[model samples]
Target chain A: MELTGAEIVCESLLKEGADVVFGLPGGAVLPLYGALSVYPAIRHILVRHEQAAAMAADGYSRATGKVGVCIATSGPGATNMVTGIAAAQMDSVAVVAITGQVPRPAIGSDAFQETDVTGVTLPITKHNMLVMDVKDVAQAIHDAFHIARTGRPGPVLVDIPRDVLLGDKTEFVWPSEPKLPGYKIPTVAPEAQVAAAADLINQAERPIIMSGHGVLISHAYGLMTDLAEKAQIPVITTLLGISAIPSSHELNLGMSGMHGMAYANLAIDEADLIIGLGMRFDDRVTGRISAFAPNAKFIHVDIDASEVDKNIKATVGMVGDLKAVLGQLLPKVEANVHIDWLQHINELKAQHPSHLVRESDELLPQYVLQRLTEVTQGRGIVVTGVGMHQMWAAQHCRFTEPNTFITSGGLGTMGFEVPAALGAQVGRPDVTVWSIAGDGGFQMTMCDIATAVEAHADVKFAILNNNSLGLVHQLQELFFDKEYIASQYTANPDFVKIAEAYGIRGIRVTRKDQVLDAVQQAMETAGPVIVDFMVKEDEGLYPFIPSGQSVKEMLEEPTLKEIT
Target chain B: MVQSNHTEQHTLIALVEDKPGVLTRVASMFRRRGFNIASLAVGNSEQPGLSRMTFVVNGDDHTVSQVAKQLDKLIDVIEVSDITNKSTVTRELALIKVKTNQMTRGEIIQIVNLFRANIIDVGSESMVIEITGEEDKINALHNLLSSFGVIEMLRTGLVAMVRGQTNGLANGHSEQVNSSSNS
Candidate 1:
C-alpha cells in the first residue's frame, strides 16, 4: 500500500523499535508531526529548543544503549542542533537526527528556512544523506539508524524535504535491513593482536587498564572486569567511562587525567603497561601527549582503527568492538598477580587522597554529593553538566552500574544535565533520574524544567549553586591573577523559585545539616522536584593538574591560596 | 594525529556508490584532514551503481593508512586500497598546450613523438600535445616543451591496476585493517 513519506518515517521508526523521539516541530516538519498521531507506538516529546532535542536524544541513547532519534526543521533548527550533534559525534553516542528541508524545487534557491544542513553537518556526523525521492525515505531512515547504531556509533543525519514528507507518489517498501556496502562494524579482534594483548597482560609487572566510553557503549563491563580481575590489574576510567566498572569494584581505581583522581593519574603515569579498552586517550586524560604514560607500552583496542594511533601510539593496536576484543583476550589471559604494583598504587592513593570535607555548618559541595550518593545507592541515573560540580560528582558520587553516570565528556558541553536527565528518565522510567549540575549550567538549560513538567518526566534536579562558575574562577585565580570578571555572578536568581515557577517542587539548602533533608525530600517527593544547594563559592576542584602538564605536576592541594 | 616521517607518494583507489555529492564528501575529507591531494581522477567503475576514484596522497605509511581508514569509514565508500608498494602498472594522461611559433612547433612535435606522445590539437600559434605514460614520462616531455613556452597543462591523476595474476582492489591490506559488522 502507498504511504506518505511521513508515514514511512513513522513505520520505519517502529521497525527500528524507536519508542520515543525528542524533537521540535517547525514549518518543514509540520506534516511529519501531524503523522505522529497515527502512530501511537512512537511518542513525540516536544523540546523548547532544537539543541535540547539532540542533547536529550544523546542522553537517552547513552543511558539506554539504544539508538536515540531527534527531529528538526531546516536552517536555524538544524544549526542549533549542531553543538549537541557534535557532542554525540565526539563521545561516539548513537543518535539519528532527522531534519526537514525546503521543498525539492526550492532547494539551493536561497529558499526561506532552507540550509545546506547535510553539508553543514558532514564533518560532525558519521554519515548523512539528503533524500530527494519519496521512495527513498524508508531506506534513508533505516540506513541512518543502522549507521548510527553500529560499530563506533555516532550521530547521523537524514534530511528530507517538506514535499517529500507530504508526497504520496510511491508505494511504501520497508527493507528488512540496510544494504549499506560501505558501513562497517568490526566485531572480533584479530587473533595475533589479542594474543599480543594477552602476552602483555601476563608478562607486565605494572599493568593497568584505562577503561573508556567504548566500554560502556559496547556493554563490555563484565569482560572489562574479568580482564582486570584475572590479572589483578587496576582499572582507571576516563570521564565518559565512569560507569563501565562499578566504583566499588576492588580493581576499579576511580577516574584519571586532569581534575581526575590524583592516584589514578599517578598510577597511569607510573605504569609500565597500559591496556586501553574502548576509550580514546583524550587530551584531558593525557595532560601532555609527550609526557603522558611516559614509560607505558599501550595496547589500544577500539572499534575505530583511526583512533588507535591518533593520540598515543599503541604497541599493540587491536581494532574491533571492545566486548569482542576483551572476550578474545580474556581467555588467553592467564591468572596473575601484580602485588607490588597494587601496593605501590595503594601508597600513592594514601599520599594523594580527596580533600576531606570539614565538619561545619557550611554546606560544602562535597558533602552534598556524598549525601546524594548515599541516597541513590547506585539506583539513580545521574546526569551532570560541565564545571566544578561535574568534577565533584565524579569524585564523590560512586557508581555500581554501567551507564548510570551520564555526562557530556568529550565535548564538555555545559547545560547538559537538566534536559539530559529528563531524557534519561524517559528512557528508563523505572529508575530514578537525577540532574547534578552547577548553578551556571542549571541556569543555561533551566527552560527545560517546563519540558520536564509538561512531559511528566520524573527527574530530581540538584543545583549545586556556587554563584560563581567555579572551574573558570579557579583557572583565573591560578593563571589570570584572580580577575573574576564575568565568571563570578554572585547576584543570581534564586534557582529554587525558578523551579517552583516551572510548576515543580523546589527546595533551598544553605546549612550543612539541611543537606540530607533536602536530598531525601527531592528523591522521595514523586513527580519532578529540584533542590538548590548553596555550595561554597570559589571551591576549586582539587587534585588539579594544569593543562599541558604531566601527571607528575598534579597538585594535591590548592596552590596560590592558603587554606582556611 | 599527524606525524612527520619519511614522506613518500601513495596512490589510493576507492570504490564508492555512484551517487550525488559523494565526490564532495571525499574531497571534503582530504581538505579537513589537511592532506594535500597531488592528483585525483574519478570515473564510472565496472560494477553498476559504483564509481571508481584514483588519487595520489603524499605522506608516510601512517598517513596513508589513516587516509584509507577514514575514507573506508564514509557510508558511500565501498572500499579504499593503498597501492603504493603494490606490484602494479600506473599511468597518467597530461594535455600540454605549448605556445609555438612556426620555428618551435616542429621541434615540440618531434620531441613529443620521441616520448610516444601525439600532437592532438594544433592552433594558429599554439599546439596541444597528449601524452599517456607514467607521471615522470609525461613530466619529461612537458619539461622538454617548457623552453618553447607552454601555455597550460592538465594532468589526469594516476590510475593503476595490479600486474598479471593479481587483483589490486581485492587485496588483504584493506580487509585486514577494517573490521566491521558484515565481516
Candidate 2:
C-alpha cells in the first residue's frame, strides 16, 4: 500500500505491538506529530523535556519487559535524549528511540535542526540506522524493535530525515521477517557448559545464587527461585535484580553489593561456589577484583557472551537466555542443605544486622520507605531516583514479585524516578506506580509532573526531602572533612507548592506519624499525587564499601572516614 | 613504533554485511576499547552483498581473542576468525613516488627491476613505482626507495586467504570464548 514515511512508522510500531510512545515534538519532527494525530492506535505521551521522553520509554520497557518507544526532533532535542538512551544502554533495557533529522540533501550541510544522531548514539546503542530513503523507514523500525528485544537487549536508534517523513508517496513493503543476516542470537546454551554449572552447584558445600536484571528480562523469576530452593542455596541480587525473588523467602538474602544487606555481602565473600544468573559483575558490585569472592568458583550464565569474562573470571560460562539455562540446570542440581553455611550467614546477619529504623520523632528516609511498603501492602511498582532515598527503598522493599523495582542501576542518573514512574504507570495502568525520589533529584525533572497530569498516568510520587544531595553530602562528610561543595541546596523550593501549581494534589509531611496517612491518601486518590516527606537530614546509610574496596572493607556504620 | 599492552600480534578476518557507517562502527569499537589496529583492508567479498575485512591486530592472545569476540558480537559482522595460526597467503600493495632526476632515474629503474616492481608513471623530477607482495616486501621497497627522496606513498593494508581450499572465516564465531589469561 502507498504510504508516507510517517505513516509507515506508525504501521511498523503497530506490527511491533507498541501501543504507547513517550515523545516531544519540535521543528524537524512536525511531520511525525502530524501523522501521529491521525494514527489513533498508538497513545502518544507528550513529555515536557526530551530527556523525560527517552527515560519514560526506558521505564516503560523495564516495567513491562517490552520494547519501549520514544521519539524526538533532531539537534538539541535528540542530544537531550542521549542521557536517557545511555541509561537504557547501560542496563540493557529494550528501547527504540526515533529522531527526526534534516533532509537527505541537507544532512552533511548542517541545516536547521540537523544532527548526526546515529553517529552520536553509535557506541551507546545496540544498533542504529539513518534511513535516507522513505522506503527504508518501515524496515528500519522493524529491524530496530527486533534488535532491541533480542539477546542482551539494549536501546536502538532510527533516524529519519524530515524530508523523508514528508517524502512522496511510496509503496510500503513490510518484510516477512527482520532482514538481518549477520545478527546471530544464541538460543540453547551449550549443554556441556550447563552441565558444568550444574556439577559445580551439586558439589558445593557453600553456594549462593546472584541474580541480575537478566532474570527479569528472561522471566526466570520462578525458575531462579526454584533452582535456589531445590539446591537449598541462599540467593542475593544485584540492585536491579532486587525483585527476582520474594524478599521474605528463606533462601533470599536480598541485595548484595555496595549498599546491600550486610549478610549478603558477607555470604558472597565466604561462598565456595557462586552461580551468577543473567548478571554482569559490575565494579560497584565487585569492588577490587583481587579480593572479590576470591574463594568463590563462578558459573556465569548470561544471554551475552562478551559479559562472561569481561569482569570476574567464569569457571563455567553459559551464554543463553537465563530462563532456558535455569531450566536446563535445575534438573542436574542435587538437593542438599548447607546447614553450617546458612548458620554462619545468620551469625553475620546478626553481627551486621541490616540496620532498621530506631526510635526517632524526626521522619527518617528509611522509616518513610518502610511505611510506604506497609501502606501499599508491598504491591506498588516502586521506581526510584538515585541517592540515599533509592538505597532505602531497595533495602526496605518487600518485593513479592519481579519487575516491581525499577531504577537507574548502570548509569545511576539522579533525575530518573519522576519520568520513569510516569512511564511505568503508563506501561502498567492497572497497578499503582510510585516514584520514590530524593528531593535533590526530584527538582531536576519535576517539569514532567505536567506530563503525568496530562497523560492521566496514575503515579504516586513520594519525595524524600533532605534539602540536599544526601548521598553526595554523606560522601563529603566521610571523605572531605565535612567541607561540602555543590552538594547542599542553600534554598530548596517547596515541592508541594510546585505540585499544586501543576494542578495535582500535594501533601507535605514532616513527622513520622503522617507518613502512612499520606501514602494511603496518594495511593487512594491517584491521578497523580505528590507527597513530600521532610526526612531527617543527617540520617546515615550503612553497608557501604568505599570505591574500589573489597567486601571485606564494607562498613557496618558510617564511622569509617578518609582524610582526602 | 606501534605500542600495545600485549606484545604479540594476531591476524583476524571478518565477513560483514555491507552497510553504511559500518566501517565507522568497527573502527569506533577499536577506538573505545583502546585497541590499536596494525593494519586493515576492506573490500567486496566473493559472497554477494557482503564485505570481507582483514585486520592485523597487535595484542596478546587473550586480547586478540576478545577483539575477535567483540567483532562477532557486532550485528553487521557475520563471522570473525583468528587466521594468525592458520596457513594463509597474505598480500599488500603499495605505490611509491620518488624524486628522480635523469641521473637517478636509471638507478631507480634498476632497483625497481631487482624487486620485480613496475614503474607505473614517470615525470620530469619523479617516478611512481608499483609493488605488490607481503607487507615486509612492500616495506623493504619503500625503505630502499626513500633514500632517493620519496615524495609520496600509499599502501593497501594486509589482505589474506587460507593457502589451500579452506575458507579463512570458519563461521565458528559462537564457539569461541574469551580466553583471558586471568579468566
> How many clashes show up in model 2?
0
Q: Rounded to one decimal, what is candidate 1's iRMSD?
A: 4.3
Least accurate 10 contiguous residues by lDDT in model 2 chain A: A555-564
In candidate 2, what are the lDDT values of residues B1-183, reduced to their tens digit? 112355687889998878888899999999998889999999998766778999999887667867887898888887889999899999999999999998888888999999999999999999899999998899889888989999999998999888876567675333231220100
Per-residue alpha-carbon lDDT of model 1 for A1-564, expressed as tens digits? 888998989989999999999999999888898889889999999899888899999989988999999999889999989999999999999999999999999999999899999999999999999999999999899888888988899999999999999976678888866767776778898898888888888889999999999898888989999888888999999989998888788788888889888888888888899999988888898988998888899999999988888777899998898888888888899998889999988887776765344454577898898888888886769999998889888888879889999999888999989888888999999889989989889888888888888889999989898887889888989889877678878578987778778888999998888888888888889888989888887666788889989877887664323233
Q: Kindly report which residue pairs in candidate 2 clash with one another.
A: none
Q: What is the C-alpha RMSD of each candidate to the true structure, in Å?
A: 2.8, 4.5
lDDT of 2 by residue, A1-564 (tens): 899999999888998999999999998888988999999999999999999999999999999999999999999999999999999999999999999988888889988778789999999899999988898888899889989998889999999888899988688888667777677777678888888888888889999999999999999999999998887899999999998898788888888888988788888888999888999999888888778888999999988878877787789988888888888888988888889999888877766667455556788888888888987777869999888999988888777878999999999999999999999999999899999999888988999999999999999888998888999998999889999899878798888888889998999998988888898898889599999998898887787888889887888764323222
Q: Backbone clashes in each candidate structure, one number apiece?
A: 4, 0
| Deviating ranges (above 4 Å) for candidate 1 | A355-361, A559-564, B2-4, B171-183
